[model samples]
Structure formats: structure tokens, C-alpha cells
Target: MNILELAEQNFLITFSVVIGIGLLQGAIMGRGIRSRFPSLKRHARSASIVLLALFSINAIASVLKFAEPVKISVSELTIPETIEEIFTLIVNVMGINAGVGAAIAIFVSVTLIIFLKFANIHQIARYFIFVISCAVLIVVLLGKFTDFVPTAFQIMLYAFYQFGITVGIFLVTKRKETDVLSGIK
Candidate 1:
């Protein structure tokens, strides 16, 4: 298949996987894992609901190619006729086409994690997210410098960046659930 076909297939697969996981997690939240603790279960239920929303939003963004974060410096801002075309041309010229969307999404998710932490929504999970996000963000920002970054490292960074968000969500949800149950708040 051609590149466009491959991209379409990838978008479909990613949308499917993200939606399926969200559904599965939602189902699991109702499985009565610890029915004895009502408050803990409530907390878990809330967290799982938020997780579902996040997964859904991210999936839509990914499928629609809205995950990309375009840098808009005040000095470089312009009123272009075709914004998408302009952005595409710029990104193509810059040669950082691969995984730019995912990197931006990771950064956004990391920001949300930090916000959630500061708001005292999920303390335990926030700490884990802070650490993981730091790692992913570092790789993403550093990836802009191809001369300094090796090809193998870029490939690995891409992989890690994609997987890191999923793992972060899972870990945060798990920790939130368990911490609530164990009276850790």
C-alpha cells in the first residue's frame, strides 16, 4: 500500500485500540474489584471515568491529526491563506515530521498531569507522572536536534514516547484506586 493508505490504516488501528482500551477499562471499573470499600471504589470510578474521557479525546485528536503542536512565536506569527498547508510545508522543510504529534500530545498530557497533581486530585499518581513525563519530554524536545541525536535514539524515543502515555494512564489509575483503598488519600 501507499503512504496515505498506510497512514489511514494506522489512524484506524490507533482509534480502535484507544477506544477499545477505554471501553475495557470502563468495564473493569464496574467489576466490583473491592466492593467492601465504597469510598475507594468511588474514587476509582471517578478516576476511571476521567481516564476514559482522556483516552477518547486523545484518540479523536490523533485520528484527526490534531495532536501536532505548532510553535507560534510572536515574531513569526503570520496570516496565511492556507494554515494547514503552511504548517505542513514548514514541518516537512524542518525535517522533524516523524512523531511530532505524539510528542506534542505527550507534552500536553504531562501538563495535565502536573495540573492534576497541584490540584490534589491524584497525589500518588502525580508523582509517577512527573517522573515519567520528565523523561518523555526530555527526549521529545531533544529530538529536534538531529545532528546531536542518533537515529537509533530517535527511533527509541518515538517508541517510548508513544508507550509512555498509556503506561502513565494505567499506573496513575492503578495507584489512585489502590491508594484510596489503603487509606493513603
Candidate 2:
């Protein structure tokens, strides 16, 4: 296995997961909308359907393009030409010891958002994302003297995770479909 291969795999895996996510989102949103205000379901259905289509096409194309080997603005940064090598490069750059754990963590977070129903969920989840962002910021701050990690990269990834999580939640739970909204109708 090499970095290029690993990167390619990541790209494919990412696209596949996003598609799976789209299906999950549709189911959850449908449940939420129908259970809450059945009247709105008819209109909301179309919007959610369109969202799924657009999301699938965009996610797949973006990942495939991103999987291509690329150079970085930072010093001595060249992405591995193979997927396996890409994993090594990622591990080396992030100082991440585990190879598959990052993907697992993302999946776990998504699962948590899906199965758990904490109070003020959207705000709570946003706060959770904020905490994640802060943790990344702290790591970057601590790594200051080291030449390896870039602060900019850390910031970017943090923002990416935050938005990604938010979107994931949106895909999984639609505003019209929530149990909380049921009483209002």
C-alpha cells in the first residue's frame, strides 16, 4: 500500500460515505417532517429530494478531484502519489499513530448525533463542534515551536470539521421533521 493508493481509497471511501449519509438524512428528515407537521411534508419532500441529488453529485466529484496528488503551500509538502503512501504521509504530518481511526472517529461522531437526542440538540452539537475546534486550536498552539504542523492547516481542518458536522446533522435531521416541532402544529 502506498500514499497514492491510500489517498485514492480515501477519496472513494469519502464519496461512498457521503452517499450513505444522504440516504440516512432522507430517512431521518422524512420521519421528522411527517411526524411533526404532515401538511408540510408534501412540500418538504421535494426539497429534501433535491438536496440528496445535489449532495451526492457534488461530494463524489469533489473527492475524486481532491484525491489527485497535489503539492502544498507549506514547505516540503508533497502528497503521496499512492493511497497507501498517502496514509503514511498523513500519519507523519498529523503525528497520528493510527491509520483508520480518523475515519472511525468521524463515523462515531455521526452516530452519536443520530442516536442521541440531547436538549437543544442543534446548539449543543454546535457547541460540541466548537469544542472540537478549540481542541485543534490548542494542539496547533502547543505545536508552535515545531516545524512540522502548520497553524493554518489546523485552523482549516477545524473549520472543515465544524461545518461537516453541522451539515451531517442537517442531513440526518430536518427542521420540519423534529419531535419538538410536532406540538406546534
Candidate 3:
């Protein structure tokens, strides 16, 4: 495949990887939060599920955008126009030049993560994940790096950012668990 095709495939794989990480993180973090705060069970569970769904949707959008496998257009998609536009801008600016639908997927997922962070969900790890991911996404969306770096490097940076989220979850989970067992009283 040509370099552009390779880039598209790399992005699709990246989105899929993020979805997997998001699901695992959500499940572990959600379970931990509910166990720590029984009163917030409903809110915690719902938020985690939505976070997973957002990532999954983005993965699907990326898949549909691949012309070699299939052709999915923004006009024919069911995702909201605002979401489509945001994704279009990100993918175009980042050099993907396809899959407005995929862009919508990642954008919404990141947006939801930010929203959860400010909603006071009681999980420090959640906030860390949002902050890190948002910083990366915002920089890419701004298209500031287009001229400075190759597209492959940008995609690799994103993959590394997602990996960092997993590490944050582990650190936060461990610290929170320790705090519970310390018996400060």
C-alpha cells in the first residue's frame, strides 16, 4: 500500500487501540470507584459506559472511512453535524484526509472524557486521563504540527498518549487503594 493508505490504516488501528484501552480503563476504574463510593454507583457506571461507547463509535467511524475496505461519507453518516465537522477538521488537518466519521468518534470520546473530569466524579485517575488526552488532541486539532512533523509521527504520538492513560489509571488506582487501607483515623 502507498504511504497515505498506510497512514489511514495506522490511524484506524490507533482508534481501535484507544477503544480497547478505554473499555479496560473504564471497567477497572468504574468498578473501583463504585466499590469505594457505594452511593455513587449509578453515576459512576453510566459515565464509564458512555466513555467506552464514545471510543467504540470513533473506531467504527475510522473503519468506515477506509476506501480500500469501504467508503463511508459524512453526508451519509448518522453522527451529528457538529461532530462530523470537528472530526473532519481533525482528520483533514492531521493529513488523514478521510473519515470525517472517524474524527467525530475520537472528538466526542475526548470531549466526554473532559466533561467527566469537570463533573467531579471523584476519581483522580479519570482527571489525569482527560487532561493528558485533551492536551494531545487539542494540539493535533490545532494543526500546528502539520508542517513540523510527518503524519506517521503524529499518529505515533497519539498512540503513546493513549498508552499513558493506561499508566495513569494504574498509578491512580494504586494510590487510591492505599489511601483507603491506611486507616488515617
RMSD of 2: 14.8
Give lDDT for model 3. 0.47
Clashes of each: 0, 18, 0
Measured with C-alpha atoms, the lDDT of residue 169 in candidate 2 is: 36
TM-score of every model versus the real structure = 0.35, 0.30, 0.35
Candidate 1 clashes: the total is 0
Candidate 2 lDDT, tens digit per residue, 148-169? 4433433333334333533543
Using lDDT as the measure, name the better of candidate 2 and candidate 3.
Answer: 3
The candidate 2 region of ten consecutive residues with least summed lDDT is 62-71
Best by lDDT: 3
Model 2 alpha-carbon drift over 4 Å, by segment: 1-40, 75-121, 129-185
The local distance difference test score of each candidate is 0.44, 0.43, 0.47
Q: Sort the candidates on lDDT, descending order.
A: 3, 1, 2
Q: Clash pairs of candidate 1?
A: none
For candidate 1, which ten residues in a row score worst on lDDT?
27-36
Best by TM-score: 1
